[model samples]
Target: MTEGTIPAALERAAERFAAREALVDGEVRLTYAELARRVRQAARFFEGHERVGICSPNTWHWVVAGLGALYAGATLIPVNTRFTARETIDVLERAKVSALAITGTFLGTDRLAELGSSRPGTVLRIPVEGAEVPFDGVSEWDALTGLDSDFVSPAKPDDVSDILFTSGTTGRSKGAMSSHRQALSVAEAWGECGGLTEEDRYLVINPFFHSFGYKAGILAAILRGATILPQRTFEVRETLHLVEAERITVLPGAPTIYQVLLDAPERGNHDLSSLRLAVTGAATVPVALVERMRTELGFDTVLTAYGLTEAVVATMSRPEDDANLVAHFSGRATAGFEVKLGEYGEVLLRGPNVMLGYLDDPDATAEAIDTEGWLHTGDVGVLNERGYLRIVDRIKDMYVCKGFNVYPAEIEQALGWLDGVAESAVIGVPDAVYGEAGKAYIRLRPGAEVSTADVLAHCKANLANYKLPRYIEFVAELPRNLSGKVLKRVLREENG
Candidate 1:
């Protein structure tokens, strides 16, 4: 249990729980001993490489490849599956990846061909079960997994484990370099916070490319002796079936996921009695929704956590907290983190979970982390007297309308309280009178109807005059990334 590196941790788990199931992906299942054997075998393929890239969906292959890179003393870079060829190439080049392990196709696109002539150094193809896609001059995953080797190079706790890129919502994505110690600290904190146990069956709906899935989902399960059920994407019916069949004990995702489940008519028919722990965060959560998930859904413990890619699992609502406090604010900082509010109401953090710096960008790194080691989270929040943090909105997302600062998150939360509103996003638009005005885009619940006037009236009663939205437009859906975050840039580009 005193392992310093991720691979070493896996080794310890294999020795203790060799017969326990470690991973499950559809028809594929691997126990701790089997997974460790495959990891050692795959590690030999990356023996000489310093940086390795993994571009695949949430599968056992992705986990094996990533852990194998660590066993070989290589830095792993998990590229986003939704990234275009240009974006993928940018990451590969910037990370100086010496090898790439990618699937042939994903969502009907030939991923390998899309990255045409942009092979980093060695290209390894991970074959999908039903996909008949083909590639030339690429090594197959079987070749690597079939190799016989037990070599594991020594890795220190301070060695860089992975470089995770930001979502680039405001600008170009910056790679946040995290050391092994930082990554493991996050896993330990999350595992303890969620009270993960050996009997828990965790269904991972979050993508592995993001920290929410990689650090909190997979590594946390490994830290405990829990079983992992990797889900590639979120679908209501399929997820319900898996939950019932797998007897899933732990399920975590964004608030939108629970909303979809609550709206489904067949949800009541599923035997979700096995569900006990539910964790969600990353967006504004309504108090009503939190109450519903517990009272209506029969969940014993529902928790909300707050963290960014730079610092994973910084604060989390404890199980003993009331529903309103869990919904209204992200709980107190974790044991190792120091949380403070800056002069301008920005949330600041200093902890082991904080990243070392941005890769290859010293200027950007300096701008993010100060001389005192406090990471300026670019987010506006208020820490109450009891130390709970209520995130207002992103500093970059705030707009000045008529000389008053307007926060979109506050408007969106208010809109969620409306009768017919399913989701809403607000952005600043050009106005002739106020220089800039609030424009709201909304998606109503199915079979629910509400007029623009009704929405405007509700906003007028709940929000200040300057904070009220000047324009309202109803849409079927709002543009969102894979992580369930609203794409404000796309909305601005379309409306502007």
Candidate 2:
């Protein structure tokens, strides 16, 4: 095993459970030995690359290829499958990806090898059971698809091993280069927060390609020698079935997932009692919802955490935090993390877990991380005298209405406390004269009748006029990624 890589941690896990199930999907399970073999085979295909692209849907293949890349001493770039062909082209062009291990045809084209070969890179199509490579002259993902079972991890402590593209909400997406040590630090911190152990079983509902899944979910689980149940989609019923059947011990999902589960009528039929810990984050967790789940589902330990693609699992509220506060504030930055309240109360983080920098964009990197090494989080929060951090809102999410500042979080929190409101998202929309006005998109509780005017009146009574949303749009549900973050930018564009 090499120094400073998750593959090193995974190797240790394999030793403990070589024949144990490491991945499962729809009755399909891969033992530790099988998983290690596939990973090595994938690595052999990329024997001499500095970087490789792992473009696949949420599956065990993505995990194997990612692990293989690190084991082979190459950086891995995880592409978002949701991107259009044009958007996918942009990311591929910018990253200068030398090779690809792809699943699912992109742009109605089956040949990733042909599409990527023209871009100064070789594309390798991963083998689909008993199938041939889709493109002529292109290497197959299984070209060397077998390992010695004596596979070892290879990575430098300071090697930047993964390049994750930002969510691109604020602007053009830039890749965050995370070093092995940095990734491991965050993963270790997450393991501690969740009280992970080899006895625990995790359901991998989050995409393995994302930073949260790679570092906190998958890597942390691997470090603990825990089993991972992978899901290719976020179907509520399918997820519940896995939890019940696998007797999953630890389940981490976005708040939206909980909301959906709670709303499911058959939710009561699933035996979620086996779930000891429920880690929720990527967005604010509603206090009422948390309380409901605790009272109804019996998950006493609901931990809320906060982090981004740049820094995986920064602040997390432990199971020890008051459920109310945990729902309110994703715990303070993890141990060794430094949070400084900058001018205007924007929270800035200084820690070993910060990304190496945005890949190939020195200017953006400089703007995000200061000379002092603090990553400007662009989030607004206030530190209480007790040193607890309370997120006020995002800098970009704050709007000015009639010369007064309105933070979306404040409004969302207020609206969330109301009856029959499952989830809420506040965005600033164009106003004729007030410059900008708050627009609230809400998802109501099942069978609950809460009129727009009634909600407006409720906000009017509790909040100042500036904070009151001028327009209210009731949505069936908020748009979210697999991680459970409300795609506010998506809503803003659609509404605009």
Candidate 3:
């Protein structure tokens, strides 16, 4: 594959598929030409800006600003849409963002004012909806949109393109700096591995703020010259309708989308035969659901990939991978990526896709990536003899039990396999006998009933006594981040 920048890739594809649909949202369809033009206009909007912050929903504005910022040779700070005013202000200050582009009065919050206070002269606000207004020295969104700038800032492989803030589930959020080359590398690699072509049409479900959503959904489709069906929000029936109506070839989402589709009664009525590839990750998926997609939904290819915001993407299970293995392992490490089990059994990664550094926090950067250049993933994993990697559990999530190591995922997986169990979360709780003991939180399927004693008895058959959860509690829903990852730290705090 020829190595080229993201803008170059999109430009080349636009030449081939100029009039072809690029992003389709019902009546609104953006062709490759239109997408390029919008991206260029966005780049023109950010001319002379050092740092531009974008806090918008999953829509054309987000993609346009993201690509535009990259083209303008300015660092982009993506503020989380769900963040409170204080949180939003925190991200802008940490990233030193001078300009901002937001959608729809930023959900009626005064966050823009809060951010403006930090950098008075440099603040530029662009509203995603309606005509942009000049607010506190910021240019109107439309005024910046029409500016003509012939300057095309060529991005090097190593130049910082975007800054993505962490979810801050455990602590303060840090901005991970991603370079143009690194982001493009992951998108291109995924395009090749998935055998993406000009004909494939992908439905974009994941939020574009996340690495998976940006690289996998928007950028990857651009590189492949494939069509993108962008959904502002995910609904089971609506997604099914789009997949059937557009003949969507690729469906990439977290386990929640799959679980919802599996439970939808209309799932049987929809024509999902067009779905060739279903790539999911960022959450643990039950093996039964994996099998059901193959037998019921007619997904010929279902893969699970594991990666973080800093690393972009590291590993994925191939289409040829055994269904059971795809259910177990997160494929092989992506091209230009290497994974090694550290002395502490933690998954350590080294690759070009690894983030350059954290914005304004060298200490946190150094803590995450060591002197040896290996990124400490803090994930417990083992590489099989066949070179497939299976993440056992998070290193931080593992607890000690009477001098024995207890992995929450091991117990959680066992619990999920039990009858009537839908989803489960396991956390370490303080115990008098042992320093810490495993506690399980469960959410049963609709109309399904199971007792704590029955769950414990079921786990006893699948797990060793040492790994058995000491306590069990049933909950209506488990605590999860926007990305659908269980926040075990929250569970531990609650147990305390």
Candidate 4:
């Protein structure tokens, strides 16, 4: 029946919900059949390619382009739209993508022009906002529609469907490869938990490049026949407007999302009564936040989940879970995963949905997944008697900065290139708005003078906005242990 893969799932959705509204992107409203036909038309453009990259904001185009690549038997590479031209080019070059679909301009920058020198043979400039200027070597996505394709070479269940890059502790990003079955399996599990239905309207505030938005938001909506409304960026007033205007039933994001909505002055001005289900995770959800989200925000169910890009949807809270439970623990293992506590309380997972491996990095993959088939997640957590999990700490130095994972090692590495840089240490500090922000302590080279502005400028050029340290300080020397390894714990203690 070819029913175990995402392409097969989309076909089923096309047949089962042909007349149902499948996607609602700004001015483009498409039903299931219309969405399917559009995906096929775009798929014809991706033929004879092995890997296709999409670097654009969330919209009808991102969905169609991503699915089109998969339908043409090409692995999808979703580049972060927040990435700088250098960072975006690095991902595209490393993946050796055969084609790329990017936005023309966003936030005053011409992204298509920025990526002009990229190696992709075929380029499609996606229309976002403002004027869509023509690029010399790029084709327009809007003009690529209406073509037909009779060729059928959709990916199989075991084929790698997407390569999502996640920054590692090594200061470089690693691409995690999820097969078709693994991606769709987690989506099915997530949809079943949220009780998604065609009658539901889903607001996707999370970025499309992220697993939360792609797997849980888009794929889950497709499987359960929910209507997807893709918001390019999250603004509090716009979110409220959409909730009231579209009668949004299912909304999921980090705890910060709900917190903002709760604290907004215009919250009561809009009719937010249709918000029913909210799936949140990434940072600790305060008990007060959960209660307020339910009673004040009018959400009937609020759940928390814990997972990384390697194996998304490992554990998630159930609808019947109490507010306290939802606030404290991520629910029991789902998506056919077995969660266990490894050495030093490190979280371990064995499942059907665990990623195949990191792209072209066997040694790294071996370190992540052991011979016993368990993926050793570098997180420390405790499981209750009922198997619910509460993440207490991270064994790795990675921290969540405003819902995005920021590796201090990366910033530290970037700092090494500065003229006066000698040694550096970065640690997480508590923040009221972002939950946690990076604090960098630096020691200059002997007799070298560098202003704070110099370091800040270097960081601004090298790192993404979320990866930039919120605070910086100059120190004479970094605290070290007997073996001369820098003691980051001492830094966090002294400063944080």
lDDT per residue as tens, model 3, 140-191: 5556556674547666656787898888887999889887788888988888
- In the range 1-496, model 2's lDDT, one tens digit per residue, is 6756767766777788788888775555887777777777777767688888877766677778888888778888888766655666777778887877776453345535335445435666654333553566666655654545455556787888889998777667899998878888898899998898878888877777787777777788777777877776688898788889889888777777788888888887888888888887644566788888788767868888778888877788876788767777778779478877998899889888788899889999999999999999898888766566778888888888999888898888888789999889999988997899999999898999999888998998889888889989998877875456777889889767
Q: After superposition, how far is residue 252 of candidate 4 from its true place, in Å?
A: 0.3
Candidate 4 residue-wise lDDT, 201-222, digit = tens: 9999888888888999899999
lDDT value, candidate 3, whole model: 0.79
Which residue ranges in model 1 land beyond 4 Å of their true spot?
129-134
Worst 10 residues of 4 by lDDT: 478-487
User: 1-496, model 1: which lDDT tens digit per residue?
Assistant: 2367898788888888899999988888899899889888878888889999999888888888888888888898999999999999999999999899998877888788889888876888877646545567788887875687668666678899999999887788999999888888889888898899888999999899999989998889888978989888889998899999999999998888888888788898899988899888855787777887888777899999889988988899888888888989888899389999996799999977789999999999999999999999989998889998888888877898999999899999999899878778899999999888999999887888899999989999999999999999999988888888889999999977
Q: What lDDT, from 0 to 1, does candidate 4 have? A: 0.84
Which residue runs of candidate 2 sit more than 4 Å off their true CA positions? 105-121, 127-133, 139-153, 494-496
RMSD of 2: 2.5
In candidate 3 the C-alpha lDDT for residue 79 amounts to 72
**Candidate 1 clashes between residue pairs 3 or more apart in a chain or in different chains:** none
The lDDT of each candidate is 0.87, 0.78, 0.79, 0.84
In model 4, what are the clashing residue pairs, if there are any? none
TM-scores vs. true structure, each candidate: 0.97, 0.93, 0.93, 0.81
RMSD of each: 1.6, 2.5, 2.6, 11.2
Per-residue error (Å), model 2, residue 418: 1.6
After superposition, which runs of candidate 3 have C-alpha atoms over 4 Å from their true positions? Answer: 1-3, 105-141, 149-151
